[model samples]
Structures are given as C-alpha cells and as structure tokens.
Target: MSATVAAILVLAVGTYAFRLVGPVLHGRVELPARLQELLAAGAVVLLVALLATGALTEGGAFAGWARPVGVLVGGVLAWRRAPFLVVVLGAAATTAGLRAVGVA
Candidate 1:
C-alpha cells in the first residue's frame, strides 16, 4: 500500500485502541476533582478553538466577514435552542444570502 494509506490505517487503529482503552479503564482509573474540572475545561477550549479556526479561516488566511457572520447567526440560533436542522439551514442561507449580496 502507499505510505499515505498505510499511515491512515495506522492512525485509524490507534484511534480505536485509544477509544477502547478509555472505556476499559474507566472505573479502574481515579481522577481528582480538580483534574476532572481541568479536563472538562480543556475540552471546551479545544472545541472553541477548532470552531473559531474553521469559521474564521480558509487556507490559513481570514475567510472574510460573511462566513464569520453566518457562524454568528448559527450560534445565535443554537443558543436560542432552535432545531439542529434549522440551525444548519439558517447558517447556510445566511452565508448564501450574504455572498449573493456581495458581502464577501
């Protein structure tokens, strides 16, 4: 197999193994309350960073204002407890409308 394919297979196996290890060791491992809180906070920070990067960037550069505006709209809808489909469609429509109006 090509090196790229082999690397992907290895990563896939490693990911599954790590996932399996979590459940298998769940009750066997003990974490302090502070550590648990830190882990939770870390996960939230990680997700926020990922979202910001994806929403605000393209090819390592700013993605223009329209995408960020669309993300903001979707975020507001989600905060208002809109349905998942509605949030997604609203974001898409907002982005499309902005682009159509030459906002990007």
Candidate 2:
C-alpha cells in the first residue's frame, strides 16, 4: 500500500480504539466529581479555542473583519435560541453582504 493509505489505515484503527475505550471503561472506572467538572470545562474551552481559531484565521493569517463579524452574528443568534437554519443563514448572509460591499 502507499504510505498515505497506510497512514490512513493506522489513523482509522487508532480512532476506533479510542472510541472503544470509553464504553470498555465506562463502569470500570469512576472519576471524582471535581475531575468530571474539570473535564467538562476543559472540553468547553477546547471547543471555544477551535471556534476562535477557525473564525479569525485563514491560511495562518487574520481572516479580516468580515468572517469574524459573521461568526459573531451567528453566535448572538444562537445565544438568543434562534433556529439553527436561521443562525446559519444569518452568518452566511452577514459574511456575503460584507464581502459584497468590499469590506474585505
């Protein structure tokens, strides 16, 4: 097999193993309450970091104001409990409108 294919196979197996580990250890391992809370907070932090990275950067540089503003609009709508479709459309429209007006 080609190196790329081999690498993909390895990664697939690794992902499957990781998925298997949760169910296999579910009842056998008990985490402290504080640890659980910390884990949940860590997950939120990681997700926010990922969102910020994707929204604010493109190809290792700033993605300009349009994309981030779009993301912010989407975020506000989501926080307001708007429907998912509306949130998506709002963000896309905000970005497209800004781009159309030569904002970026």
Query: Top model by lDDT, which number?
Result: 2
C-alpha lDDT of residue 60 in model 2: 100
Query: Model 2, range 2-93, lDDT digits (tens) per residue?
Result: 99999999999999999999999999999999999999999999999999999999999999999999999999999999999999999999
TM-score (C-alpha, index-matched) for candidate 2: 0.84
Model 2 poorest ten-residue lDDT run: 95-104
Error of 1 at 64 (Å): 0.6
Q: Report the number of clashing residue pairs per model.
A: 0, 0
> 19-93 in candidate 1: lDDT tens per residue?
999899989999999999999999999999999999999999999889999999999999999999999999999
TM-score of 1: 0.82
- Weakest ten-residue segment in model 1 by summed lDDT: 64-73
Q: Please report, in order, the local distance difference test score of every candidate based on alpha carbons.
A: 0.97, 0.98
User: Which pairs clash inside model 1?
Assistant: none
